[model samples]
Target: MEYAQLGRTGLKVSRLCLGTMNFGPQTTEEDSHAIMDRAHELGLNFFDTADVYGWQKGEGITENIIGRWFAKGGGRRERTVIATKLYGDMGDWPNDGRLSALNIRRAADASLRRLQTDHIDVYQAHHIDRNTPFEEFWEAMEVLRQQGKILYVGSSNFAGWHIAKAQETARRRNFLGLVSEQSPYNLLVRAPELEVIPACEDYGIGLIPWSPLFGGLLGGVLRKLDRVRSAASDLVTELERNREKIERYEAFCDELGEQPSHVALAWLLHRPAVTAPIIGPRTVEQLDGTIRALEVKLDDKALARLDEIFPGHRPAPEDYAW
Candidate 1:
Protein backbone atom coordinates (compact mmCIF):
# COMPACT_ATOMS: atom_id res chain seq x y z
CA MET A 1 0.00 0.00 0.00
CA GLU A 2 1.16 3.53 -0.77
CA TYR A 3 1.49 6.17 1.93
CA ALA A 4 0.93 9.91 1.73
CA GLN A 5 1.00 13.02 3.94
CA LEU A 6 -2.42 13.84 5.41
CA GLY A 7 -2.71 17.49 4.25
CA ARG A 8 -0.74 19.99 6.30
CA THR A 9 -0.82 17.94 9.49
CA GLY A 10 2.45 16.15 8.64
CA LEU A 11 0.79 12.81 9.41
CA LYS A 12 1.47 9.94 7.06
CA VAL A 13 -1.48 7.61 6.40
CA SER A 14 -2.07 4.70 4.11
CA ARG A 15 -3.33 5.53 0.61
CA LEU A 16 -6.29 3.30 1.38
CA CYS A 17 -8.00 3.76 4.76
CA LEU A 18 -9.94 0.80 6.20
CA GLY A 19 -13.42 2.05 7.12
CA THR A 20 -15.42 0.22 9.84
CA MET A 21 -18.95 1.41 9.16
CA ASN A 22 -20.25 -2.15 8.85
CA PHE A 23 -18.56 -3.51 11.97
CA GLY A 24 -21.47 -4.28 14.24
CA PRO A 25 -24.51 -4.70 12.08
CA GLN A 26 -23.49 -6.07 8.70
CA THR A 27 -20.21 -7.57 9.98
CA THR A 28 -19.45 -9.60 13.10
CA GLU A 29 -16.82 -8.51 15.61
CA GLU A 30 -14.65 -11.47 14.71
CA ASP A 31 -14.87 -10.61 11.04
CA SER A 32 -14.11 -6.98 11.73
CA HIS A 33 -11.10 -7.88 13.89
CA ALA A 34 -9.83 -10.29 11.27
CA ILE A 35 -10.18 -7.61 8.62
CA MET A 36 -8.21 -5.18 10.75
CA ASP A 37 -5.53 -7.78 11.31
CA ARG A 38 -5.29 -8.47 7.61
CA ALA A 39 -5.11 -4.76 6.78
CA HIS A 40 -2.32 -4.26 9.30
CA GLU A 41 -0.47 -7.25 7.92
CA LEU A 42 -0.73 -5.68 4.48
CA GLY A 43 0.81 -2.37 5.70
CA LEU A 44 -2.42 -0.42 5.94
CA ASN A 45 -2.06 1.89 8.93
CA PHE A 46 -5.17 4.08 8.79
CA PHE A 47 -8.67 3.19 10.06
CA ASP A 48 -11.83 5.29 9.82
CA THR A 49 -15.02 4.95 11.83
CA ALA A 50 -17.84 7.14 13.10
CA ASP A 51 -20.16 7.14 16.11
CA VAL A 52 -23.15 6.93 13.79
CA TYR A 53 -21.91 3.89 11.90
CA GLY A 54 -23.62 0.45 11.86
CA TRP A 55 -27.37 -0.20 12.03
CA GLN A 56 -29.58 2.76 12.92
CA LYS A 57 -30.34 1.21 16.32
CA GLY A 58 -26.70 0.30 17.05
CA GLU A 59 -25.33 3.79 16.56
CA GLY A 60 -21.96 3.41 18.25
CA ILE A 61 -21.10 -0.26 17.93
CA THR A 62 -18.32 0.35 15.41
CA GLU A 63 -16.35 2.47 17.89
CA ASN A 64 -17.07 -0.04 20.65
CA ILE A 65 -15.53 -2.80 18.55
CA ILE A 66 -12.38 -0.78 18.01
CA GLY A 67 -12.24 -0.01 21.72
CA ARG A 68 -12.49 -3.71 22.53
CA TRP A 69 -9.81 -4.50 20.00
CA PHE A 70 -7.51 -1.97 21.62
CA ALA A 71 -8.28 -3.08 25.19
CA LYS A 72 -7.41 -6.66 24.25
CA GLY A 73 -3.76 -5.65 23.83
CA GLY A 74 -4.06 -5.35 20.11
CA GLY A 75 -0.60 -3.86 19.42
CA ARG A 76 -2.16 -2.50 16.26
CA ARG A 77 -3.73 0.34 18.22
CA GLU A 78 -0.42 2.11 18.79
CA ARG A 79 0.72 1.69 15.20
CA THR A 80 -2.49 2.55 13.38
CA VAL A 81 -3.86 6.08 12.92
CA ILE A 82 -7.54 6.14 13.90
CA ALA A 83 -10.08 8.70 12.66
CA THR A 84 -13.67 9.10 13.86
CA LYS A 85 -16.49 11.60 13.53
CA LEU A 86 -19.05 13.48 15.62
CA TYR A 87 -22.18 15.70 15.06
CA GLY A 88 -24.62 13.08 13.82
CA ASP A 89 -27.90 12.84 15.72
CA MET A 90 -27.93 9.77 17.94
CA GLY A 91 -31.24 10.37 19.72
CA ASP A 92 -34.20 12.74 19.93
CA TRP A 93 -32.58 15.27 22.29
CA PRO A 94 -32.59 18.72 20.65
CA ASN A 95 -29.09 19.84 21.67
CA ASP A 96 -27.56 16.36 22.01
CA GLY A 97 -25.89 16.27 18.61
CA ARG A 98 -24.69 19.69 17.50
CA LEU A 99 -21.06 20.84 17.40
CA SER A 100 -21.42 23.19 20.30
CA ALA A 101 -18.81 23.13 23.05
CA LEU A 102 -21.08 21.05 25.28
CA ASN A 103 -21.74 18.47 22.60
CA ILE A 104 -18.10 18.38 21.51
CA ARG A 105 -16.95 17.69 25.04
CA ARG A 106 -19.61 15.06 25.57
CA ALA A 107 -18.97 13.38 22.25
CA ALA A 108 -15.18 13.39 22.61
CA ASP A 109 -15.34 11.86 26.06
CA ALA A 110 -17.75 9.20 24.87
CA SER A 111 -15.62 8.39 21.85
CA LEU A 112 -12.43 8.24 23.93
CA ARG A 113 -14.12 5.91 26.39
CA ARG A 114 -15.40 3.67 23.63
CA LEU A 115 -12.12 3.58 21.66
CA GLN A 116 -10.07 2.98 24.81
CA THR A 117 -7.74 5.67 23.60
CA ASP A 118 -6.73 8.92 25.18
CA HIS A 119 -6.76 10.92 21.94
CA ILE A 120 -8.20 10.57 18.48
CA ASP A 121 -5.76 10.94 15.57
CA VAL A 122 -8.27 12.87 13.52
CA TYR A 123 -11.54 14.20 14.92
CA GLN A 124 -14.00 15.23 12.24
CA ALA A 125 -17.32 17.03 12.10
CA HIS A 126 -19.53 14.50 10.28
CA HIS A 127 -21.49 17.25 8.57
CA ILE A 128 -22.04 20.97 8.73
CA ASP A 129 -24.66 21.93 11.32
CA ARG A 130 -26.31 24.98 9.81
CA ASN A 131 -27.90 25.68 13.16
CA THR A 132 -24.48 26.45 14.69
CA PRO A 133 -22.28 29.33 13.67
CA PHE A 134 -18.94 28.35 12.09
CA GLU A 135 -17.02 30.14 14.83
CA GLU A 136 -18.99 28.40 17.56
CA PHE A 137 -18.43 24.96 16.05
CA TRP A 138 -14.74 25.51 15.37
CA GLU A 139 -14.17 26.90 18.85
CA ALA A 140 -15.51 23.64 20.29
CA MET A 141 -13.13 21.63 18.16
CA GLU A 142 -10.26 23.86 19.28
CA VAL A 143 -11.03 23.00 22.90
CA LEU A 144 -10.55 19.31 22.12
CA ARG A 145 -7.18 20.05 20.55
CA GLN A 146 -6.09 22.10 23.56
CA GLN A 147 -7.15 19.28 25.89
CA GLY A 148 -5.09 16.79 23.89
CA LYS A 149 -8.21 14.79 23.05
CA ILE A 150 -7.69 15.13 19.32
CA LEU A 151 -4.58 15.79 17.25
CA TYR A 152 -6.20 17.15 14.09
CA VAL A 153 -9.63 18.27 12.87
CA GLY A 154 -11.46 17.65 9.62
CA SER A 155 -14.87 18.05 7.96
CA SER A 156 -17.01 15.60 6.02
CA ASN A 157 -19.81 16.04 3.47
CA PHE A 158 -19.20 19.79 3.52
CA ALA A 159 -19.37 21.97 0.44
CA GLY A 160 -16.64 24.33 -0.79
CA TRP A 161 -18.25 27.42 0.71
CA HIS A 162 -18.62 25.77 4.11
CA ILE A 163 -14.98 24.75 4.09
CA ALA A 164 -13.90 28.25 3.12
CA LYS A 165 -16.07 29.71 5.86
CA ALA A 166 -14.57 27.40 8.44
CA GLN A 167 -11.07 28.29 7.35
CA GLU A 168 -11.85 31.99 7.46
CA THR A 169 -13.42 31.63 10.87
CA ALA A 170 -10.34 29.84 12.17
CA ARG A 171 -8.06 32.48 10.71
CA ARG A 172 -9.88 35.34 12.41
CA ARG A 173 -10.05 33.50 15.75
CA ASN A 174 -6.48 32.15 15.51
CA PHE A 175 -7.77 28.59 15.95
CA LEU A 176 -6.81 25.35 14.24
CA GLY A 177 -8.71 24.95 11.01
CA LEU A 178 -9.77 21.81 9.22
CA VAL A 179 -6.77 19.93 7.86
CA SER A 180 -8.71 17.49 5.77
CA GLU A 181 -12.02 16.76 4.02
CA GLN A 182 -13.86 13.48 3.56
CA SER A 183 -16.29 13.35 0.66
CA PRO A 184 -17.74 10.86 -1.81
CA TYR A 185 -15.62 10.63 -4.97
CA ASN A 186 -15.46 7.85 -7.53
CA LEU A 187 -15.71 7.15 -11.24
CA LEU A 188 -19.47 7.56 -11.13
CA VAL A 189 -19.21 10.65 -8.89
CA ARG A 190 -16.87 13.40 -10.04
CA ALA A 191 -18.89 16.10 -8.36
CA PRO A 192 -16.13 16.93 -5.89
CA GLU A 193 -13.79 17.87 -8.74
CA LEU A 194 -16.09 20.70 -9.70
CA GLU A 195 -15.58 22.60 -6.44
CA VAL A 196 -14.46 20.74 -3.29
CA ILE A 197 -11.28 19.43 -4.89
CA PRO A 198 -10.24 22.89 -6.02
CA ALA A 199 -10.93 24.38 -2.62
CA CYS A 200 -8.92 21.71 -0.81
CA GLU A 201 -6.11 22.11 -3.29
CA ASP A 202 -5.95 25.86 -2.77
CA TYR A 203 -6.20 25.61 1.01
CA GLY A 204 -3.69 22.76 1.39
CA ILE A 205 -6.30 20.50 3.00
CA GLY A 206 -6.22 16.75 2.49
CA LEU A 207 -9.04 15.02 0.67
CA ILE A 208 -10.17 11.63 1.92
CA PRO A 209 -12.81 10.19 -0.34
CA TRP A 210 -15.50 7.85 0.94
CA SER A 211 -17.59 5.63 -1.34
CA PRO A 212 -14.83 5.62 -3.90
CA LEU A 213 -16.67 2.68 -5.39
CA PHE A 214 -19.93 4.59 -5.49
CA GLY A 215 -21.47 2.45 -2.74
CA GLY A 216 -20.58 -0.70 -4.68
CA LEU A 217 -22.25 0.49 -7.87
CA LEU A 218 -18.82 0.36 -9.51
CA GLY A 219 -18.09 -3.04 -7.96
CA GLY A 220 -19.39 -5.04 -10.96
CA VAL A 221 -21.98 -6.85 -8.82
CA LEU A 222 -24.17 -3.75 -9.14
CA ARG A 223 -25.05 -4.87 -12.64
CA LYS A 224 -27.78 -7.01 -11.05
CA LEU A 225 -30.40 -5.65 -8.69
CA ASP A 226 -30.31 -8.74 -6.42
CA ARG A 227 -26.55 -8.45 -5.96
CA VAL A 228 -26.74 -4.71 -5.29
CA ARG A 229 -29.56 -5.14 -2.75
CA SER A 230 -27.38 -7.51 -0.76
CA ALA A 231 -24.56 -4.94 -0.61
CA ALA A 232 -26.13 -1.51 -0.17
CA SER A 233 -29.21 0.49 0.68
CA ASP A 234 -31.02 2.66 -1.93
CA LEU A 235 -29.45 0.60 -4.71
CA VAL A 236 -32.80 -0.38 -6.15
CA THR A 237 -34.03 3.19 -6.17
CA GLU A 238 -30.74 4.54 -7.49
CA LEU A 239 -30.68 2.02 -10.30
CA GLU A 240 -34.15 2.99 -11.32
CA ARG A 241 -32.98 6.54 -11.99
CA ASN A 242 -29.56 5.77 -13.54
CA ARG A 243 -29.82 2.38 -15.18
CA GLU A 244 -28.55 3.64 -18.50
CA LYS A 245 -25.69 5.53 -16.87
CA ILE A 246 -24.73 2.37 -14.95
CA GLU A 247 -24.57 0.31 -18.12
CA ARG A 248 -22.50 2.96 -19.84
CA TYR A 249 -20.03 3.12 -16.92
CA GLU A 250 -19.75 -0.67 -17.03
CA ALA A 251 -19.03 -0.59 -20.75
CA PHE A 252 -16.36 2.05 -20.16
CA CYS A 253 -14.80 -0.17 -17.51
CA ASP A 254 -14.84 -3.12 -19.93
CA GLU A 255 -13.25 -1.05 -22.67
CA LEU A 256 -10.40 -0.26 -20.30
CA GLY A 257 -10.04 -3.98 -19.45
CA GLU A 258 -10.49 -3.28 -15.77
CA GLN A 259 -13.02 -4.37 -13.18
CA PRO A 260 -15.59 -1.71 -12.37
CA SER A 261 -14.34 -1.34 -8.78
CA HIS A 262 -10.73 -1.09 -9.85
CA VAL A 263 -11.49 1.57 -12.42
CA ALA A 264 -13.56 3.49 -9.94
CA LEU A 265 -10.88 3.57 -7.21
CA ALA A 266 -8.00 4.09 -9.62
CA TRP A 267 -9.77 7.08 -11.05
CA LEU A 268 -9.97 8.71 -7.64
CA LEU A 269 -6.32 7.97 -6.82
CA HIS A 270 -5.28 9.44 -10.13
CA ARG A 271 -6.42 12.84 -8.92
CA PRO A 272 -3.72 15.04 -7.33
CA ALA A 273 -6.07 16.38 -4.66
CA VAL A 274 -7.16 13.07 -3.16
CA THR A 275 -5.07 11.86 -0.22
CA ALA A 276 -6.84 8.54 0.32
CA PRO A 277 -10.02 6.61 -0.32
CA ILE A 278 -11.85 4.90 2.54
CA ILE A 279 -12.57 1.22 1.82
CA GLY A 280 -15.40 -0.50 3.71
CA PRO A 281 -15.88 -4.22 3.32
CA ARG A 282 -18.16 -6.62 5.15
CA THR A 283 -15.88 -9.57 4.36
CA VAL A 284 -12.30 -10.36 3.46
CA GLU A 285 -13.27 -11.24 -0.11
CA GLN A 286 -14.76 -7.82 -0.63
CA LEU A 287 -11.67 -6.14 0.80
CA ASP A 288 -9.41 -8.22 -1.41
CA GLY A 289 -11.11 -6.84 -4.51
CA THR A 290 -10.83 -3.25 -3.27
CA ILE A 291 -7.20 -3.62 -2.18
CA ARG A 292 -6.23 -4.74 -5.67
CA ALA A 293 -7.51 -1.42 -7.04
CA LEU A 294 -4.44 0.44 -5.79
CA GLU A 295 -2.26 -1.46 -8.26
CA VAL A 296 -4.43 -0.85 -11.32
CA LYS A 297 -2.84 2.31 -12.66
CA LEU A 298 -4.87 4.44 -15.06
CA ASP A 299 -3.15 6.17 -17.96
CA ASP A 300 -4.25 9.42 -19.56
CA LYS A 301 -6.09 7.58 -22.32
CA ALA A 302 -8.11 5.52 -19.86
CA LEU A 303 -8.85 8.52 -17.68
CA ALA A 304 -9.93 10.53 -20.69
CA ARG A 305 -12.19 7.71 -21.78
CA LEU A 306 -13.77 7.60 -18.35
CA ASP A 307 -14.26 11.36 -18.37
CA GLU A 308 -15.90 11.08 -21.76
CA ILE A 309 -18.32 8.51 -20.42
CA PHE A 310 -19.09 10.14 -17.08
CA PRO A 311 -18.20 13.74 -18.14
CA GLY A 312 -16.85 14.61 -14.68
CA HIS A 313 -20.16 16.40 -14.16
CA ARG A 314 -21.96 16.63 -10.86
CA PRO A 315 -25.24 14.77 -10.74
CA ALA A 316 -28.12 17.02 -9.71
CA PRO A 317 -28.79 15.01 -6.60
CA GLU A 318 -25.24 15.59 -5.25
CA ASP A 319 -25.34 19.35 -5.64
CA TYR A 320 -25.28 21.62 -2.57
CA ALA A 321 -27.71 24.49 -2.99
CA TRP A 322 -25.99 26.39 -0.25
Candidate 2:
Protein backbone atom coordinates (compact mmCIF):
# COMPACT_ATOMS: atom_id res chain seq x y z
CA MET A 1 0.00 0.00 0.00
CA GLU A 2 1.20 3.49 -0.78
CA TYR A 3 1.66 5.84 2.22
CA ALA A 4 1.18 9.56 2.54
CA GLN A 5 1.70 12.08 5.33
CA LEU A 6 -1.55 12.80 7.22
CA GLY A 7 -2.03 16.46 6.35
CA ARG A 8 0.99 18.46 7.59
CA THR A 9 1.76 15.95 10.30
CA GLY A 10 4.88 13.85 9.86
CA LEU A 11 2.97 10.62 10.50
CA LYS A 12 2.54 8.35 7.46
CA VAL A 13 -0.73 6.46 6.79
CA SER A 14 -1.99 4.15 4.05
CA ARG A 15 -3.89 5.67 1.14
CA LEU A 16 -6.87 3.47 1.98
CA CYS A 17 -8.17 3.34 5.58
CA LEU A 18 -10.16 0.38 6.88
CA GLY A 19 -13.45 1.43 8.48
CA THR A 20 -14.89 -0.99 11.11
CA MET A 21 -18.48 0.16 11.45
CA ASN A 22 -19.68 -3.23 10.22
CA PHE A 23 -17.56 -5.30 12.59
CA GLY A 24 -20.23 -6.47 15.00
CA PRO A 25 -23.44 -5.86 13.05
CA GLN A 26 -22.58 -7.26 9.62
CA THR A 27 -19.49 -9.39 10.44
CA THR A 28 -18.89 -11.87 13.22
CA GLU A 29 -15.98 -11.55 15.65
CA GLU A 30 -13.82 -14.28 14.11
CA ASP A 31 -14.35 -12.94 10.60
CA SER A 32 -13.61 -9.40 11.75
CA HIS A 33 -10.30 -10.58 13.19
CA ALA A 34 -9.42 -12.36 9.96
CA ILE A 35 -10.22 -9.28 7.89
CA MET A 36 -8.07 -7.11 10.15
CA ASP A 37 -5.26 -9.64 9.90
CA ARG A 38 -5.46 -9.50 6.11
CA ALA A 39 -5.45 -5.71 6.18
CA HIS A 40 -2.33 -5.71 8.35
CA GLU A 41 -0.60 -8.23 6.08
CA LEU A 42 -1.43 -6.02 3.10
CA GLY A 43 0.03 -2.90 4.83
CA LEU A 44 -3.29 -1.13 5.39
CA ASN A 45 -2.15 0.26 8.72
CA PHE A 46 -4.89 2.80 9.31
CA PHE A 47 -8.18 1.67 10.88
CA ASP A 48 -11.14 3.91 11.80
CA THR A 49 -14.05 3.18 14.10
CA ALA A 50 -16.54 5.05 16.24
CA ASP A 51 -17.93 4.56 19.72
CA VAL A 52 -21.41 4.68 18.22
CA TYR A 53 -20.83 1.99 15.61
CA GLY A 54 -22.52 -1.42 15.65
CA TRP A 55 -25.69 0.57 15.09
CA GLN A 56 -28.70 -1.71 15.65
CA LYS A 57 -27.65 -3.84 18.64
CA GLY A 58 -25.86 -1.14 20.62
CA GLU A 59 -22.90 1.23 20.65
CA GLY A 60 -19.27 0.13 21.15
CA ILE A 61 -20.01 -3.45 20.04
CA THR A 62 -17.63 -2.97 17.14
CA GLU A 63 -14.98 -1.50 19.41
CA ASN A 64 -15.36 -4.47 21.74
CA ILE A 65 -14.78 -6.78 18.77
CA ILE A 66 -11.62 -4.84 17.92
CA GLY A 67 -10.53 -5.08 21.57
CA ARG A 68 -10.74 -8.86 21.36
CA TRP A 69 -8.60 -8.84 18.23
CA PHE A 70 -6.03 -6.70 19.96
CA ALA A 71 -6.04 -8.97 22.98
CA LYS A 72 -4.91 -11.92 20.84
CA GLY A 73 -1.37 -10.53 21.18
CA GLY A 74 0.05 -10.84 17.64
CA GLY A 75 1.55 -7.31 17.52
CA ARG A 76 -1.67 -6.24 15.76
CA ARG A 77 -1.93 -3.22 18.01
CA GLU A 78 1.60 -2.11 17.25
CA ARG A 79 1.27 -2.40 13.47
CA THR A 80 -1.82 -0.22 13.10
CA VAL A 81 -2.70 3.46 13.31
CA ILE A 82 -6.07 3.32 15.11
CA ALA A 83 -8.60 6.16 14.76
CA THR A 84 -11.99 6.37 16.48
CA LYS A 85 -14.71 8.94 17.03
CA LEU A 86 -16.89 10.29 19.81
CA TYR A 87 -19.92 12.67 19.89
CA GLY A 88 -22.81 10.25 19.63
CA ASP A 89 -25.55 9.42 22.11
CA MET A 90 -24.06 6.58 24.09
CA GLY A 91 -26.63 6.92 26.88
CA ASP A 92 -29.92 8.46 27.84
CA TRP A 93 -28.34 11.45 29.52
CA PRO A 94 -27.76 14.68 27.55
CA ASN A 95 -24.05 14.71 28.36
CA ASP A 96 -23.62 11.17 27.10
CA GLY A 97 -22.74 12.58 23.70
CA ARG A 98 -21.41 15.81 22.17
CA LEU A 99 -18.07 17.58 22.75
CA SER A 100 -18.54 18.93 26.23
CA ALA A 101 -15.46 18.66 28.45
CA LEU A 102 -16.96 16.04 30.75
CA ASN A 103 -18.27 13.97 27.85
CA ILE A 104 -14.94 14.09 26.00
CA ARG A 105 -13.15 12.81 29.09
CA ARG A 106 -15.73 10.09 29.68
CA ALA A 107 -15.75 9.07 26.00
CA ALA A 108 -11.97 8.79 25.68
CA ASP A 109 -11.65 6.54 28.69
CA ALA A 110 -14.50 4.39 27.42
CA SER A 111 -12.96 4.10 23.95
CA LEU A 112 -9.51 3.17 25.27
CA ARG A 113 -11.02 0.39 27.33
CA ARG A 114 -13.12 -0.93 24.46
CA LEU A 115 -10.20 -0.94 21.99
CA GLN A 116 -7.96 -2.62 24.59
CA THR A 117 -5.31 0.02 23.92
CA ASP A 118 -3.80 2.54 26.27
CA HIS A 119 -3.67 5.33 23.66
CA ILE A 120 -5.48 6.34 20.48
CA ASP A 121 -3.50 7.45 17.43
CA VAL A 122 -6.18 9.90 16.37
CA TYR A 123 -9.29 10.75 18.40
CA GLN A 124 -12.03 12.56 16.49
CA ALA A 125 -15.26 14.41 17.11
CA HIS A 126 -17.91 12.64 15.04
CA HIS A 127 -19.79 15.88 14.40
CA ILE A 128 -19.95 19.52 15.39
CA ASP A 129 -21.29 20.31 18.86
CA ARG A 130 -23.20 23.52 18.47
CA ASN A 131 -23.92 23.53 22.22
CA THR A 132 -20.30 23.36 23.38
CA PRO A 133 -17.82 26.08 22.57
CA PHE A 134 -14.63 25.18 20.69
CA GLU A 135 -12.58 26.41 23.65
CA GLU A 136 -14.12 23.83 25.96
CA PHE A 137 -13.68 20.99 23.49
CA TRP A 138 -10.02 21.68 22.73
CA GLU A 139 -9.19 22.16 26.39
CA ALA A 140 -10.42 18.63 27.07
CA MET A 141 -8.55 17.26 24.05
CA GLU A 142 -5.41 19.09 25.20
CA VAL A 143 -5.66 17.29 28.49
CA LEU A 144 -5.94 13.97 26.66
CA ARG A 145 -2.85 14.85 24.59
CA GLN A 146 -0.81 15.90 27.61
CA GLN A 147 -1.68 12.63 29.34
CA GLY A 148 -0.65 10.70 26.20
CA LYS A 149 -4.13 9.21 25.85
CA ILE A 150 -4.51 10.59 22.32
CA LEU A 151 -1.72 11.54 19.91
CA TYR A 152 -3.76 13.74 17.55
CA VAL A 153 -7.26 15.16 17.02
CA GLY A 154 -9.60 15.22 14.00
CA SER A 155 -13.15 16.08 12.86
CA SER A 156 -15.95 14.57 10.75
CA ASN A 157 -18.85 16.05 8.74
CA PHE A 158 -17.69 19.60 9.41
CA ALA A 159 -18.27 22.54 7.07
CA GLY A 160 -15.52 24.73 5.58
CA TRP A 161 -15.85 27.52 8.15
CA HIS A 162 -16.01 24.95 10.92
CA ILE A 163 -12.48 23.86 10.03
CA ALA A 164 -11.31 27.43 9.91
CA LYS A 165 -12.89 28.15 13.29
CA ALA A 166 -11.34 25.03 14.81
CA GLN A 167 -7.86 25.80 13.55
CA GLU A 168 -8.05 29.42 14.66
CA THR A 169 -9.17 28.36 18.12
CA ALA A 170 -6.32 25.84 18.37
CA ARG A 171 -3.80 28.46 17.30
CA ARG A 172 -4.97 30.95 19.89
CA ARG A 173 -4.76 28.32 22.62
CA ASN A 174 -1.40 26.90 21.41
CA PHE A 175 -2.96 23.57 20.55
CA LEU A 176 -2.29 21.30 17.55
CA GLY A 177 -5.87 21.62 16.23
CA LEU A 178 -7.49 19.30 13.68
CA VAL A 179 -5.16 17.19 11.54
CA SER A 180 -7.86 15.68 9.32
CA GLU A 181 -11.46 15.91 8.08
CA GLN A 182 -13.69 12.96 7.14
CA SER A 183 -16.60 13.66 4.81
CA PRO A 184 -18.76 11.91 2.24
CA TYR A 185 -16.96 12.33 -1.08
CA ASN A 186 -17.33 10.20 -4.18
CA LEU A 187 -17.92 10.34 -7.93
CA LEU A 188 -21.63 10.77 -7.14
CA VAL A 189 -21.03 13.18 -4.24
CA ARG A 190 -18.86 16.12 -5.34
CA ALA A 191 -20.26 18.58 -2.79
CA PRO A 192 -17.04 18.74 -0.79
CA GLU A 193 -15.20 20.29 -3.73
CA LEU A 194 -17.20 23.48 -3.19
CA GLU A 195 -15.49 24.69 0.01
CA VAL A 196 -14.46 21.92 2.42
CA ILE A 197 -11.63 20.78 0.15
CA PRO A 198 -10.30 24.30 -0.27
CA ALA A 199 -10.50 24.98 3.47
CA CYS A 200 -8.66 21.79 4.31
CA GLU A 201 -6.01 22.63 1.71
CA ASP A 202 -5.50 26.07 3.21
CA TYR A 203 -5.30 24.73 6.78
CA GLY A 204 -2.95 21.82 5.98
CA ILE A 205 -5.60 19.33 7.08
CA GLY A 206 -5.73 15.96 5.36
CA LEU A 207 -8.99 14.71 3.85
CA ILE A 208 -10.16 11.19 4.73
CA PRO A 209 -13.27 10.83 2.57
CA TRP A 210 -15.97 8.42 3.69
CA SER A 211 -18.62 6.75 1.48
CA PRO A 212 -16.26 7.07 -1.48
CA LEU A 213 -18.46 4.71 -3.55
CA PHE A 214 -21.78 6.46 -2.93
CA GLY A 215 -23.30 3.46 -1.18
CA GLY A 216 -22.19 1.09 -3.95
CA LEU A 217 -23.62 3.21 -6.77
CA LEU A 218 -20.15 3.52 -8.24
CA GLY A 219 -19.31 -0.05 -7.20
CA GLY A 220 -21.26 -1.69 -10.04
CA VAL A 221 -24.57 -1.27 -8.27
CA LEU A 222 -26.56 -1.62 -11.47
CA ARG A 223 -25.02 -5.02 -12.14
CA LYS A 224 -25.64 -6.10 -8.56
CA LEU A 225 -29.23 -4.84 -8.75
CA ASP A 226 -29.68 -6.98 -11.83
CA ARG A 227 -29.06 -10.02 -9.60
CA VAL A 228 -30.09 -9.13 -6.02
CA ARG A 229 -33.36 -7.27 -6.95
CA SER A 230 -33.41 -5.34 -3.65
CA ALA A 231 -31.51 -2.39 -2.19
CA ALA A 232 -31.77 0.34 0.42
CA SER A 233 -34.44 2.89 -0.48
CA ASP A 234 -32.09 5.86 -0.31
CA LEU A 235 -29.55 4.07 -2.50
CA VAL A 236 -32.29 3.16 -4.95
CA THR A 237 -33.37 6.80 -5.09
CA GLU A 238 -29.82 8.03 -5.67
CA LEU A 239 -29.30 5.49 -8.44
CA GLU A 240 -32.52 6.54 -10.17
CA ARG A 241 -31.51 10.22 -9.94
CA ASN A 242 -28.11 9.60 -11.51
CA ARG A 243 -28.96 6.71 -13.83
CA GLU A 244 -27.85 8.42 -17.00
CA LYS A 245 -24.47 9.49 -15.59
CA ILE A 246 -23.87 6.06 -14.07
CA GLU A 247 -24.55 4.41 -17.43
CA ARG A 248 -21.80 6.46 -19.04
CA TYR A 249 -19.48 5.88 -16.10
CA GLU A 250 -20.01 2.12 -16.20
CA ALA A 251 -19.31 2.12 -19.94
CA PHE A 252 -16.16 4.13 -19.25
CA CYS A 253 -15.04 1.54 -16.69
CA ASP A 254 -15.93 -1.29 -19.09
CA GLU A 255 -13.65 0.15 -21.75
CA LEU A 256 -10.85 0.34 -19.16
CA GLY A 257 -11.39 -3.31 -18.08
CA GLU A 258 -11.62 -2.24 -14.46
CA GLN A 259 -14.37 -2.58 -11.86
CA PRO A 260 -16.43 0.54 -11.26
CA SER A 261 -15.45 0.47 -7.55
CA HIS A 262 -11.76 0.46 -8.41
CA VAL A 263 -12.14 3.46 -10.70
CA ALA A 264 -14.16 5.33 -8.06
CA LEU A 265 -11.47 4.82 -5.42
CA ALA A 266 -8.67 5.67 -7.89
CA TRP A 267 -10.45 8.89 -8.73
CA LEU A 268 -10.53 9.95 -5.06
CA LEU A 269 -6.80 9.12 -4.72
CA HIS A 270 -6.09 11.67 -7.43
CA ARG A 271 -7.79 14.54 -5.60
CA PRO A 272 -5.37 17.11 -4.19
CA ALA A 273 -6.17 17.18 -0.45
CA VAL A 274 -7.22 13.56 0.04
CA THR A 275 -4.89 11.42 2.16
CA ALA A 276 -7.09 8.34 2.40
CA PRO A 277 -10.57 7.10 1.52
CA ILE A 278 -12.30 4.91 4.08
CA ILE A 279 -13.18 1.45 2.76
CA GLY A 280 -15.59 -0.64 4.87
CA PRO A 281 -15.54 -4.15 3.45
CA ARG A 282 -17.71 -6.82 5.12
CA THR A 283 -15.90 -9.96 3.92
CA VAL A 284 -12.35 -11.08 3.29
CA GLU A 285 -12.93 -11.20 -0.48
CA GLN A 286 -14.37 -7.69 -0.35
CA LEU A 287 -11.40 -6.56 1.71
CA ASP A 288 -9.07 -7.99 -0.94
CA GLY A 289 -10.98 -6.22 -3.72
CA THR A 290 -9.88 -2.81 -2.38
CA ILE A 291 -6.27 -3.53 -3.23
CA ARG A 292 -6.95 -3.56 -6.97
CA ALA A 293 -7.96 0.10 -6.82
CA LEU A 294 -4.39 1.07 -6.01
CA GLU A 295 -3.33 -0.08 -9.48
CA VAL A 296 -6.08 1.55 -11.61
CA LYS A 297 -4.68 5.05 -12.03
CA LEU A 298 -6.72 7.22 -14.42
CA ASP A 299 -4.84 9.19 -17.11
CA ASP A 300 -5.78 12.72 -18.21
CA LYS A 301 -8.39 11.58 -20.72
CA ALA A 302 -10.11 9.31 -18.24
CA LEU A 303 -10.11 12.04 -15.61
CA ALA A 304 -11.57 14.55 -18.02
CA ARG A 305 -14.38 12.17 -18.91
CA LEU A 306 -15.23 11.66 -15.23
CA ASP A 307 -15.16 15.43 -14.72
CA GLU A 308 -17.63 15.89 -17.53
CA ILE A 309 -19.96 13.34 -15.95
CA PHE A 310 -19.72 14.62 -12.35
CA PRO A 311 -18.89 18.32 -12.86
CA GLY A 312 -17.60 19.31 -9.40
CA HIS A 313 -18.15 22.78 -7.98
CA ARG A 314 -15.51 25.51 -8.06
CA PRO A 315 -13.75 26.77 -4.93
CA ALA A 316 -15.86 28.95 -2.58
CA PRO A 317 -15.78 32.64 -3.42
CA GLU A 318 -15.71 32.06 -7.14
CA ASP A 319 -18.46 29.41 -7.02
CA TYR A 320 -20.68 31.78 -5.04
CA ALA A 321 -19.63 34.99 -6.83
CA TRP A 322 -21.05 34.10 -10.23
The TM-score leader among the candidates is: 2
lDDT of 2: 0.93
Residues 200-231, model 1: lDDT tens digits: 98888999999887766777755566776764
Q: Could you give candidate 2's per-residue lDDT for residues 27-113 as a string of tens digits?
A: 999999999999998999999999999874236899999999999998999999999999988988878888999999999999999
lDDT of each: 0.84, 0.93
The CA root-mean-square deviation of candidate 2, after full C-alpha superposition on the true structure, stands at: 1.1
> What TM-score, over all chains together, does every model reach?
0.91, 0.98
Candidates' RMSD to native:
3.2, 1.1
Runs in model 2 lying further than 4 Å from the true structure: 56-58
In terms of TM-score, how similar is model 2 to the real structure? Answer: 0.98
Cα miss at 164, model 1 (Å)? 0.3
Off by over 4 Å in 1: 56-59, 222-226, 229-233, 313-322
TM-score of 1: 0.91
